[model samples]
Target: MENTSCCIYTFSPYIFLNAYGGLHGGAVAAVAEMVSIACARTVVSKDKDLFLGELSMSYLFAAPRNAEVIVDASVVRSGRNVTAVTVEFRLGESGGVVYTAKATFYNMPVASL
Candidate 1:
């Protein structure tokens, strides 16, 4: 299957904001994971199972509430047992990068039952 290279996410006030009224770190991490998995799924064969092995993120700026953010994820490396993806979160349109993440996924063949 062809993988989607990028997607847009809109932060809801209730779901994405922290008590301080900024985008929550955990929420950002979750989105990074989702995007990385989506990118990894594009390159793997149908029978192979992909699992997230490691995820790391750097927060460069605070994301504003109720804004549309762009998430771009791409496969940086694909190997026999592992795939690495990099994801970036940017504010609407030309806004600066708010966060960046790297995710590693382990690719394993599914055992037939």
Candidate 2:
């Protein structure tokens, strides 16, 4: 509950696009990573730094221009040295799942606080 985040993302031409005029894969991954990190940070200590260890994404459907998508990110587990998060993207109107991602981050302690 406390480790979750939800936002609406509107696809625009300003963002990268794929050959099919849908959101680019890299752009999708970037959005997923950003949201996941925010979710993970809710439980992670500020003195530590999060290094993205792994990110896995699945693009289920195409999100075209001007399409609004609901992005949801949640922390699965936040350990002392690792944090795991899951992100989902769905069409805002139809609620069809468009993308899914899972990311794992390694927590490294800062030398000075």
- Please state every model's RMSD to the true fold in angstroms: 2.9, 2.4
Clash-forming residue pairs, model 1: none
Cα displacement (angstroms), candidate 1, residue 98, comes to 0.2
What's the lDDT for all of these models? 0.81, 0.83
Residues 5-104, model 2: lDDT tens digits: 5433554444578888888899899999988887788888888999999999999988977788778888877788988898999887898999999999
Candidate 1: tens digits of C-alpha lDDT, residues 39-92: 788787878999899999999988776766778888888888998888888887
For each candidate in turn, the TM-score is 0.85, 0.86
The runs of at least 3 residues in candidate 2 whose Cα sits more than 4 Å from the true structure, single-residue gaps closed, are: 1-14
Report backbone clashes per prediction.
0, 0
lDDT value for model 1: 0.81
Candidate 1: count of backbone clashes, pairs at least 3 residues apart or interchain: 0
